[model samples]
Target chain A: MAGERSSMSEKLRVLVVDDEALVADFIADLVEEAGHEVIGIAATREKALEYLERSAIDLAILDIRLKGRLNGIDLAQATRAREIPHMFITGSGDPSTREAAEATGPLAILQKPFSQERLVSVLSQMAQRDHSLN
Target chain B: MRILFVDDDPDTRALAIRAVTHEFPNATIREAMDLTSLDEVLQERPPEILVTDFDLRWTDGIKIFDRVKAANPLCCTVMFTGTGNEELAVRALKHGFDDYVVKGSKQLRRLAITVRSAYERNNRLRELGESRDLVLKELYHRLHNNLQLVISLLRMTEKTLGHESDRQQIADLGRRIQALSALQEEFYRSEDFRRVNFSSFLERLARNLLETSGGRIELTAELNLVELPVDLAVPLGLIANEILNATLKHASPDDRPGHLSMRLEQIAETLILRISGDGAGSGEDPDTAKTGLGMRLIQRLATQIEGEVSLEHHAAGAAWQVSVPL
Candidate 1:
């Protein structure tokens, strides 16, 4: 699967947005491990949108609850307007949170402590879906 | 209490009327000599108690008992039988007749006692049944909610866990939990928690997998209408989830579109499940395809249901077939 992925025209350019620095870096590492390039890791909505404006990111992984006034769901809604496909990584399973996240039609929702296998699997699948879209 | 007495023989009819009147002085009794009169009397006023001779002129007492029970489930019925009709009386009792009284000069005296006791027993049984249903419904509700809670906690843990190996284990555990949660949700949707409609259950399970697959695959199902006991449905659902995850993981090639298909049918006494997907199996050893935690789990689940799992590679894709006792 990795070999086939490497043969693609380009590695997926992924942006990671989360309030937690450690978690942000963790997702970046996983994205890189999955053969995707992490353009930037944003700990706030402002920084995340800044990265989106600066870089051509193919995908985004947003944390539902962020530190700032605008959370990951807000970022997701913004991404929808940008026509950027994204997924969610969240620590909470509140229905309201899930509902808001789902309203974005995310590629996938990665719960905390998600295994490397799941991350790679989902990212690659999302990459394929994104590729077909392009 | 209003009682309907049906007996073709006038002498036996008179006997029953005397016994019932003696038992309850305030009771209003109606008499029917044949099936026509029985139907008319039933239409006029359905009885709280129906005491009738097993051998009627037009139809047997069993038919009358069935009619009354069908029209009004709360109606208590007693089938009066002669000496040689004892076996028939037992059969009627097994078929939901409240009780049966043997017809004889002396034994006929017990008819009124049987009628009164049976009616009381029927009322108590009805109350008990309603209460049991309420309790079962409450228990199912709590069980469903608790299962959702566990899945939520697992999902949260999956997001936070650091080690890749540990996260994989948690992810696997989470999938199993989700499978159980799906079953509970199905139970909530169903009126009978003891049996699951296999076709609908699998349809929902397949759609759920498709939802998480990121639209990279097209899923099609050919399912037979089969109802399975709750015990079998849970493990079978888990097995389906495991195999689905495996297909989503391995079968999807980076370049081409992926297709996953599932078919379930009952052949003879065995239930057969076939799940196949376009993946890496072409030109690869079928034996190697079977070497995975998913395959092992499938095997274990098959054994749990007294079945076997087979992994095969065809020209188009890889497939797993599971055959279990129905």
Candidate 2:
């Protein structure tokens, strides 16, 4: 219990962004319970950028699917430039999505239907990563 | 030999099936489009090599290659990407991918040569891998025994020292020497080390390092998996060790997990070892240093192959770029 509490005390600030509202919510709840704040929830490229423009999100949990002439990759590339640590969340697990996801260049990929435990672990690990723009 | 030709259009398949079968009457042929059908055909009868389109409707050739490799690592794979990236074609060859041929062109005759060449290369590698697998354990043992002798000699050469710092330096040197010996082990364990999978070698090294480091952090290496001549591989390995050691030393608990990018690009007749990373704790560029042990060692290794090394501030992080003759 003490270990868990200490883990939560870090209280990382993360953004839960995906096209699927349910997935975004599910992740939002998980990261929050892990003791991190879900600073924003975004379902579209525009929404992600809007949230970025509005809030200082420490991490971005981006879905490969997004609205309007853009995709999770675009958001990922955008976030990369901003020095925001991010990972792709996907349901398809299909080749096309996997190829596109790989090209976008995230730190690591968490396949769809990943366990809450796995999701939290990835978020925690990435959240603690140094973000100084170099 | 049997060859599996995959295409959705029956006519294309018919034409290809004819083209090769007619040339080699003993050759057998089969075709597939989707993964399901491919699996079925493969189960019924397996082919020695596979010729597939890079952009199939339901499944692409890369997927086919993956499935084929899983099914039989010995099976040769050729990609007919029509007109995919020449760069991808070049890289695909680095990871045991036999060959890449552009599709539907005046290069039909060229395709014939390619098919023959890939078949020989693939079969040669397969034969080597198979024969060596039988002797892998014996090879590993012999190489280890030999290295132990070298290590003993190295220890004797170092001056006797009991200081804590001196002992620590010896330990560090011992570990690096053991890593250097892995190249010899790789030569024996693998079919040959002259043309080896640098990426796989690095992965094994990373796993070893991570285990020593208590396995707390996850280290991922994105290697393009290029193979260089033995003359190049020796120096390339040492240079890589230096950069890798630097990254591991500098990567901190608070810092993001360090990512290392190593690319060996063949520019003109020169093969370049461009190793760089986002992490740095300690490393000196010996080029300017009068006598930097680390820098001089790396410089000497590069020059052994008539290669040149330079430090550049790349977009991702700092880069150590080495270019050498092929």
Candidate 3:
């Protein structure tokens, strides 16, 4: 089964959004290695909205605690409006922020210091679920 | 040196960052609401000295200082905790804490001032970092104001040349210089002390220029971005003022519209500003070889930033392109 899953095609299209450039790049690298195509990376809410409007990415990985005036809660609201699927990756698991993320329906919240393997597995699952829904 | 505040309350952390920064403005102050964050802040920006509280959720202040000592024995340590007992403070000092303070409402103000004064005295010798910045900031403002006064005097004397255009030009340039100086004064007065966010700054600059424009042209801007420092924001604001004045003066009333638009941009490190309008259909570019007061002011402001200016006259209107490297 693992071998069959590895050989599967129709590469997953992913968008990684994080304010920190290094974290965004790391997510992109991990996603690509998991047989998915990383489309683009955005560091701001405006840029991410633009990407969502124009692109056909299968799923997005949003970091909760962003640098700008808008945080993950704001981005999730935007995604919900468009009915886009997303999972959150955060350096923090604070109760308030976790509650906010949970109110947006079923979301996979992964704590920071996460490994590349964990990222690939979670994103791969999200991409597959999105594909089946579409 | 590093001062750490470990408490579950956000107020305490903020109070600590403010109080410690006030005491040793140059020293790196890091706070942790808990030990984990304290450890993280420490790992990122290590302070020369360490301070902690005895009562923490995950770890005690004693363990925190011991970790600090283990990481670097040279780091000075101070422990202050409200819930902690004397045994903890004694243990912390014995291990590595250079000083200890008890948190109490009774002696709160006294304890704070004491901690602050002690921190200042301990770091007084090598703590000239912020003092240097303060002196340099003072020097910058003094130079700018002196230059403005000199320019104002020259302008006042020049207006008496008895030529309408010369007097108008002199007054215009005078206002532009004054605007620049005012912006400099305001910038140093800001909390950040070096940058001006452009949206509100430009709005005020436009209002000031319109007041000085004698009600000829209505000024408006469609600003989309913010966050430019004093070096660029002040000159950009002045350049916009001068450009608007020149366009209004040179254009025929029938030929040009009563309003001009100034749009600014900050694309990464490159800042671009465009001033465009129907120059009363005269086809004359105000930003040209024919020198005038506004032209001279724009030139000076542009050269100050080592930027370039170009004049473009299209069918719809004329526009000035100003680009600078930040």
Candidate 4:
């Protein structure tokens, strides 16, 4: 499945945002392995904002809770303004939190400990959409 | 229970305390004639029951009620006043006073009875609230532990990865963990924290699974409302996940968009779940099918619920049916 997706879809420049270094690195590895470039990995909303300002990122995978005051939803507002597509990969199962995250209009809100295929599938779709748009 | 009597008149406070002590022989009674005494009593130990007079020189019964509630929100309050009117009684009750009694030689006994009744009712409510909090805390703790377990297992699996087969196993395990997490979310959403709407859970599970297919598999669901307890729902949900996962895996190799249909119905004493897909076995991957882990898991889950699972192959597609006694 990885080979098929890599061959058929255009590669995307992705930014991974999560507070936990292990989770952020794991997602970064998955994004890179799925034929996408990991432009930056940020553990806080401030760092994520810095990456967004400096890089032409095609996608951002965000974790809702961050190391700092601002959470991923706040960062998503900036991504929305810049017309950058993003998705949430969160550990929160709180309905109110999910509703708030959904209000930001993400591509998907994949729960924590989600399958690699699920994330790769979303990435593949983003790549295909990017390919078609260009 | 501890009782606080607040009134400016010393004789009125004494009369009220005497009646309450006679009714509750083992009760600890305290009196407060002004703000200083009230603060001293409240700070020393908040009362479980408060009886205050409305026409006090320093404060009204309403203000006294507010103070006692601020100290202990669960404190039961009774207004024992000589200046009570119908409107004042209404206002006191609306302000969350437990009972109102006009001061008379006969009303003292009524005040004791009202206080006793209100205290009992309050005790019941407090117990209910405590139980609900305990259930929520336990659910939260269990969910945290389960998530930690899944993360630990994943980390261990990653460290031991050698071949593509191991990677596939990890992905499958992740989906199963997600199925359990979805159940936990449903439990939280449930009003009673006891039963979950299985139909809604099924629809959500199907939609999420199909979402990963990227519109390759179209889903049609005809689900009947069925609420099941946690023990029954857990295995059923896992079984549904495995069957759906297997179907999607089989359907993926087909180039054309596939149609997957799911139906859930409760008939008499049994719940019937049927799932079918037109893309079944079109380009079957012998490697994934050879493992048979999904099928084995389904059978084991069915046994746990004392249910039955049946699979059928047809010219157009394949179908799976699971029936569990309701």
Candidate 5:
């Protein structure tokens, strides 16, 4: 059963959203390295929304402080409305912000400069879930 | 110290300035007879002390107080006016005026003394605030630098290694360091540098671990209010992390979902932490046995805080418990 599940796990179509271009590309590289495809990389909430509207995404990795009037939390709300599963990767350790992010029911909130293994673990989990659902 | 006197009456302003100069010979005094002069003096430099009349031609003392406070929140303000009554004095004091003096020949000396006292108190408070800010900044700087240094060292070491398992071990070490960094953040949010709200830390830990489980593990926590000093909290946090990680790792096998529960409560000056998972039995995994680093870490961390650890293996799952005197 383990072997069957591993073989069935598919590459996730991921959206990487961050204000910093370098960090967004780094996350995109990590996603691709983890056997997932980076469908879009967005620097602002509007750009992310545009990607969401234009393509089909399996998952989204978002940074909370985006480069616009709307932020990652607002983007998460949009994803929730669209039934798109997402997780947060944020630099802010503020408690109130954490509370608000958790309210959006993200798959996880990975703090900034997180270990590569952590992101891989979450991506693998999402892939396995997709496999199971299929 | 810099002092600004705002009064429409030139005679009263002159008398108040003389009294303040006598009390604080080194003080720089600026007089404002109207809105124009007040704005000019305020633009030059925000005063450390403000003396204003309650009844001014253009603005009241309270307005002046608001403006000065907006410019410099620590500025000491005194209301000196002839048109002042008991109601007006109460209003002035409520508006953050340090002193309210009625314009009388005898009250000039009293106003000077009150201003001096307020100035000294404000100075002490400002010094204390600056000291606290300095300490917090230094702590933040050291923590950020150290975390970056450790990560770079780990990365450098990982590069020299050829084996996959060795790289995996380095990644595990990086995760542990990240956990410690999270704990440091909790400490920073604390009122005092020495202690943290352990319950919140546990919640964050649980979210970090299980939220990414993709609905494979269900987590239920019964965490009461518990604040532990950094010394105890750090080890206990690491121990809890180890236990939870092991439980969840073994809990879901072959895509089988599992349930993990944690309870942290204080009972009669003792803290009891209980974590259990309804997963595969401990006998199935040799890594969870007594010889593994995870088990050893749990034991050593328990011992560091004079705590006791016990493990129970049942047909359904495994449970680990740790108890320490508060």
Candidate 6:
């Protein structure tokens, strides 16, 4: 049953949002490599919000700092309000930023540039949790 | 050493002069029988040691002590009284009197010894203060140099990552490390070695950030002068850096010139900091805006120092206000 549940979550749709195109693409690749589907890539809060409304995103990787007026943190909060599981991908490892991110109860904060191993492991853990919830 | 004896009674004054003179034969001794003569003697030549009767007919002996101590902080004082008790002894000692001698043959013999020891102790105190200052200065100097080395390493790494997508991230870390180095330099430059003139620090930091950005934005700062402890200054400086980073990143378009302003002042029991920029105010929801790295950092900094943070968005700009307990 656990193996079947894991396989189901492995195909979960994930959304990636970051202002930097290269970083966003890199994160999407990591998500895809982890046996998850990349549903969309959003550069700003508006774009990310629109994707959330139009797509069935099971999980998200958001950047805390984005290019537009609305940042990744805002997107994370929006995802949280909808009870969507998410994590933050940020270059800032500042203690204060970590503290704030922790308050939002994210699955994990993926420090940029993305590490393939860490990203895969974190996604596996999240997928396991998502399956168990079902 | 030169000694001065001030007493109301002629016999006691003469006896004091004889005792001090006999104890140190090479010493110069002056005598004053009343307040009037005490002033004259002090004006002519200030003595290294002042031995006075605590109770005088015209005035209290504290007057003489105050005059001498005010003139030379290092001057040793020995109060001699015919009617002094433990209370008077305690009172005199508390008011900077080095030693006190009650009117007796034995105590008078010890007067000379007391004066000698008093000067010796004062000399030792001055020496200790100077040595402590020297050690602290050297410690901060070494710390500053070591922090600079770390910054250099970070910079070298940043340079090698130019083609990488994460090069900007490395550069950001370098900037924070450089801020730490700047903090160490402030300690090295400060006379006290523990406190910083924060207004000057903020000014230098803002100008450095602007210069690094190639002067794309105009910054105006209205800061009140304040001396802050190292603990408060370090985190506060980082918060300022993060805020400045946000303004530089979001406040203006790349092709247009922008304006940034920062103000820090103390009002009553609280310190207020306002960092604002005349950029397009993103009409984003506050809950989402609060999650920005810069915003979270500002909030975290405020939390560390027991402060409150508020965000404001106007048609012209957006502002962050942090109020901390001073």
Q: Going through the candidates in order, what is the number of backbone clashes in each? A: 10, 1, 3, 0, 0, 1
Instruction: Say which prediction, candidate 1 or candidate 4, comes out ahead on lDDT.
Output: 4
Model 5 is docked with a DockQ of: 0.09
lDDT per residue, candidate 5, B262-316, as tens digits? 9999999899999998977622254546887778888898889999988888877
Calculate DockQ per candidate and list them.
Answer: 0.03, 0.01, 0.01, 0.14, 0.09, 0.01
> Which candidate has the top score in lDDT?
4
Superposition TM-score, candidate 3 onto the true structure:
0.41
Instruction: Give stretches of model 4 more than 4 Å off.
Output: A1-10, A68-70, A78-83, A103-105, A115-118, A128-134, B1-162, B280-291
* TM-score attained by chain A of model 3: 0.83
- Candidate 3's displacement at residue B186, Å, is 3.4
lDDT of 6 by residue, B273-295 (tens): 88888866422345666776666
Q: Which candidate is the best by DockQ?
A: 4
Off by over 4 Å in 3: A1-134, B1-77, B80-159, B214-216, B229-238, B251-257, B279-306
Q: What share of the reference contacts survives in each candidate?
A: 0.00, 0.00, 0.00, 0.13, 0.07, 0.00
lDDT tens per residue, model 2, B136-217: 6445434443444444444444447767667656655655665566455445435575666666656655555444333444
Ordered from best to worst lDDT, the candidate numbers read 4, 5, 1, 6, 3, 2
- What's the fnat for candidate 1, on a 0 to 1 scale? 0.00
The numbered model that scores best in TM-score is: 4
Model 5, residue B109: displacement in angstroms? 3.7
Q: What's the CA error at residue B122 for candidate 4, in Å?
A: 7.1
Better structure of 1 and 2 per lDDT: 1
Q: Can you give the lDDT of residue A20 in candidate 4?
A: 73
| Residue ranges of candidate 6 with Cα displaced over 4 Å | A1-134, B8-10, B21-47, B55-63, B82-91, B164-167, B181-200, B213-220, B224-231, B249-257, B279-296
Scanning candidate 4 chain A in windows of ten residues, the lowest lDDT window is: A1-10
Candidate 5: give its CA RMSD in angstroms: 10.3
- Compose the digit string of candidate 4's lDDT tens values, residues B94-152: 99998889999888888888888888988898899989876775566446434735664
